[model samples]
Target: MKNASPRWFTSSYSENGGVCVEVATNLAASHGTVPVRDSKTPTGPSLAVSAEAWTTFVAMTRH
Candidate 1:
């Protein structure tokens, strides 16, 4: 895959103060990974999780 930039975005439901994480799902198709970082620190280190794992995690949280 090419070097794709991560387009970070926070959830609309995360309105409870400034404690939230940002996710870059835009690279899931091209990179097969989802980069996640803290909303408080945009320049901080991010965690790269597998696309499949991220999907499962989100599905579990919805239950």
Candidate 2:
């Protein structure tokens, strides 16, 4: 996707000195995926996880 531009946001549970990831769930509707990146390196590489997989991961984390 050449024109993929995701608006990323960090989780509220993230700590001040802890490593965390930023996610752009907004692109899921059109891209069918959620973009994830390290909060410490915004310009670094990002991973695009499928919506189904992302949902599963989120569900697992809640428990």
Candidate 3:
């Protein structure tokens, strides 16, 4: 939904001087996807990743 508001946030592990991506997982359940965007440009475009893909990525990062 274009009207949907995404709550974007970076991971706690991000310590590279703000050079990291922000993800809005809040809409995953309803939209079936995770919205990712650059922290430097909140007004810019975002990438919508499938929930499954997001889960896999997180799992890999945890390893």
Model 1 poorest ten-residue lDDT run: 1-10
lDDT of each: 0.95, 0.92, 0.91
What's the TM-score of each model vs. the native?
0.92, 0.88, 0.88
By lDDT, the best candidate is: 1
- Whichever of 1 and 3 has more lDDT, that candidate is 1
Model 3 score (lDDT): 0.91
Candidate 2: lDDT over CA atoms?
0.92
* Predicted candidate 2 versus true structure: per-residue lDDT over 1-63, tens digit per residue: 556679999999998775999999998988899999999999999999999999999999999
* The 10-residue segment with the lowest total lDDT in model 3: 1-10
lDDT of 3 by residue, 1-63 (tens): 555778888988899697899999988988999999988888999999999999999999889
Off by over 4 Å in 1: none
**Residue-level error in angstroms, candidate 3, position 30:** 0.5
- Per residue, candidate 1 scores C-alpha lDDT tens digits across 1-63 of 588899999998899688999999999999999999999999999999999999999999999
